[model samples]
Target chain A: MSLIAVVDYGMGNLRSVDKALEHVARDGQEVRITSSADEILAADRVVFPGQGAARDCMRELESRKLIEPVMQAAKEKPFLGICMGLQVLLAHSEENDGVDCMGLYPGNVRFFGKVLNQDDPAEPLKIPHMGWNNVNQTIDHPLWQGITDGSRFYFVHSYYVDPEERSIIAGETTYGIGFTSAIACDNVFAVQFHPEKSATDGLKLLENFTHWDGK
Target chain B: MSLAKRIIPCLDVDNGRVVKGVQFVDIRDAGDPVEVARRYDEEGADEITFLDITASSDNRDTIVHVVEHVAEEVFIPLTVGGGIRKIEDVRTMLNAGADKVAINTAAVFNPEFVKEATDRVGSQCIVVAIDAKQVSAEGEPLRWEIFTHGGRKPTGLDAVEWARKMVDYGAGEILLTSMDRDGTKIGFDIPLTHAIAEAVSVPVIASGGVGNLEHLAEGIIDGMADAVLAASIFHFGEFTVHEAKQHMAKRGIEVRL
Candidate 1:
């Protein structure tokens, strides 16, 4: 029996994430949304899900005194970071002028320019890159067990991460340019797309996360 | 691979029950919005939009229950539109597990509502729904005027300029629906959709007037819409979301199959 602590920082839809996890969680594997440092530290796995601006996410985590517990949990067990959860792992973000992040991984978050696909002026590339896009598996990881090499995941964001060490990059997706979509190293596995909302392929990643021992 | 064009099935809910005028197909319980949402999610629908057409404001809270049940089961992104006039309304929908809230008449009545929403909530959750009707006569300069109150009232606003203004006002996305072709089942207003999509930097969801799968793909191909939304086609079981994706893919448009 293991506990999965979903860090609740009052950003985005924490309910859906919790429900999706509970849907796939095996029997006796408890899943709870908690800001309690003790529960987070005691959990077998941690899922940090973020939404909204990077500045606001940091502020909420700092205000709730969750930063320490989240960092500790990431270092301790199998951790999954999603969307802003993945962005905040980097050193800094270009959004909201600039915002400092957890620095769990060395990377800088940069914005997608106003126009994407400059070659095709006919299609005015929508910002926030809001749609289903393919994520090419760059490394052989446990999470890619059933998901195809270029499976599409739901993504909605203006900024993408750039890890200081490229080896940490696990998945790459092409929007305007190929950016790091998923990153993994040791016990940590983070994704810029919301696997909870990514349908069948997404559920497969979560299922893999449940079975991964963080090798 | 590039970003795949999205296909969204919209549900019109009136007083908590999915309106039965269009989606009268074999959905076990056709009135149940959650059942319908789950069906679409299983069939490979990229997203689901709930257009709350609740006539009375008192019964507006019913839509929240519907969203709560659907979001509880369905994992895909959920968008809630209709009767979003106040910030509290936006919060209620988001709290109900909606990934996005489309502000239609409220944003048209007061453009400041869009900015206030973006400031209060993130722009990502705020989608501006524009219902515009072609006002230009055939053979004349192409132009459309914004229509409010379900295409009954004219706001005297230029549809394309208003879309740009909303984007600048911090709207993350625009849901453009053609009032003229809404129920005709012929197709979407291609030029109108093409105009607004070209005008805005945010993703535009082309809605209304989708009789068949070809109409859905046309929005992405010629109109350049980031996503295509329809109700009657899928609800009536004429075609599935899989069929729509296959049709778009064969047409050379990238779609998740």
Candidate 2:
């Protein structure tokens, strides 16, 4: 089994995802979190986990000289983006420093400013959308393999993804309204929810990613 | 869409060292500020603040050096304060790669300094940090007196009123630290936080008195703070950033996972 590389850009949650990958992968399958571009390119699978703003995360990648390598890896290997990681895969984000992103997927990440009710609010559904919420898989994809519909996973973000192509959506979750919760196009797969914090169901999703053979 | 509650880690640094001391105790030693900062960045900290605790603002060069190192090493936004006196000081810090420069003593000493710095650096880059202590009486004004020089001197300025003036002068954000609970770990000063939050249209970051995850959650949910800042809990490794986010999520505070 080829080792999985978790890209480290000096910003984001690196350890929990590393541990979660270890927890799900079969014996002898290894996962390493690295900032080295060479290791990222050599790996069979790459997981880009981000915990900061979209622009800052991209700046870190550029500062480390890993943008080209990461973009190339997205094309060559099975790539996964978690949380803000998923958002940066798009053409651009509204929260960006007015810079273009990796453009691995054809979509734009935007804040849900229109949906926020002026009155009678559910006090908890404030910005950062941090918590465990259920997702309904909208498209058939291997990343969601063995995971059923309405399965709760961890989500923490203020922005939502709206793909230019509706066919790319793999899952949907409801906050103030149902938005695209996950995306898959070709070899690229991304989820707005955090599988690392999704508990048993999350581990199962990781297992599916480890064994997926689809192109 | 609800605004995302940010998870920020604060570092109290003195003489190029990270130290945690209450009003009257031997300061507990922490490790290198850079190394600790790197770890937090990797663990997914939304932002980091470096508060220089020493009294003097003379070592502007040293502050620049620290900012350069942190910028080269860490990816998230860095906010540094303590002894920042003038627009030139703000320029020096920002040129050294600090995303935001916080001001306390200078803002209190010369209220116009806040306006001048904000104009020079742009309102978004200028942050007015306030240290407050709650008053004793009821039916009287519930005043939050501003403290300066690392909580050593009282400015005779009401925190709420100061906050209003700072906003009027074009400050984009406020960093409010409570001296009464600076090292107590009891919890954040919620009433004070709400008052300030209510008083200002700009974002308010509640600093001091965060002992555990519950304190952080309460600061955001009940206190209405835009962000919660703490030093001991994060510095001593009481909880990982991920664990805190998990706890906050459980309590219904929006966090980045």
Query: Which candidate tops lDDT?
Result: 1
Instruction: Tell me how each candidate scores on DockQ against the true complex.
Output: 0.84, 0.05
TM-score of each: 0.97, 0.57
Question: Cα miss at A51, model 1 (Å)?
Answer: 0.8
User: What Cα-based lDDT does every candidate model obtain?
Assistant: 0.91, 0.76
What global local distance difference test value does model 2 have?
0.76
lDDT by residue for model 2 (A67-173), tens: 89888888888888888678888888887435577887777888765574443443423444544567888877887877777776756566899889899899888
Local accuracy of candidate 1 as per-residue lDDT tens digits, B46-144: 999999999897898899999999988898999999899999999999989899999999898889999999988889999999999999888999999
In model 2, the number of clashes is 6
Q: In candidate 1, how many Å is residue A110 off?
A: 0.7
Query: How well is each residue in B55-107 modelled by candidate 2, as lDDT tens digits?
Result: 56565466677776776556556789987887887877776667678988888
Q: Give the TM-score of candidate 1.
A: 0.97
